[model samples]
Target: MTCVSCRTGLDHCHGTVLLHVDGGAECTEPDCADAVLARHALVVDCDSIEGGCACEVTAERLAHAS
Candidate 1:
């Protein structure tokens, strides 16, 4: 996977999520917010750090989806 931010392969660049966070304040997020949230959050990363995402693969997924 290549990082969308740096255009560097993930294997070479250190793994990190620029906007990653965990256990943030709970709120009733609207369903319509998925796209926006997905843009700002990493969906699968929640399992890694709890309520947070690592956005590492998103670039790859986005790259593939397109």
Candidate 2:
């Protein structure tokens, strides 16, 4: 799986916020929120994960949708 925040595609960090925009879903790690906001200049509804991170949550959601 790929991490949207670092974009490292490695399991280094977890995402904190799941950003839902017009086209697709994106995410940001706790430390990467500022960077993500700077890059994506669109209105997004942030979904907070209770125990999981955005990366894990989003992946699970996508899998279920499929």
Candidate 3:
């Protein structure tokens, strides 16, 4: 899916899926929980990275749990 605001297609984003909850209210659909987040502003780690910022997993990680 893509952001209705930014229109940035995250369809091809190849990372774990997770949720975006706020307070007692959920931010989005159950699909929102399908994304895996980094839990930090800009910090992440992968099992097998090729050649990228190990901590720069923003786009993917930010897809949820921000």
- What is the TM-score of each predicted model, taking all chains together? 0.20, 0.24, 0.17
- Which structure is stronger by lDDT: 1 or 3? 1
lDDT tens per residue, model 2, 24-66:
5555645553435445434345444456445556776788999
* Rank by TM-score (best first): 2, 1, 3
Candidate 1: worst-modelled 10 consecutive residues by lDDT: 9-18
Each prediction's RMSD over C-alphas, in Å, is 15.9, 11.9, 14.5
* Candidate of highest lDDT: 2
- Model 1, range 2-66, lDDT digits (tens) per residue? 45644743222222223333333222234332333323333333335555344535555777899
**Which candidate, 1 or 3, has the higher TM-score?**
1
Model 3 Cα lDDT, one tens digit per residue, 13-50: 23333222221222123444433343112213332334
The stretch of ten residues in a row with the least summed lDDT in candidate 2 is 8-17
- lDDT values, one for every candidate: 0.38, 0.49, 0.35
lDDT of model 1 at position 51:
50
| Candidate achieving the largest TM-score | 2
Question: Model 1, residue 4: displacement in angstroms?
Answer: 35
Off by over 4 Å in 1: 1-53
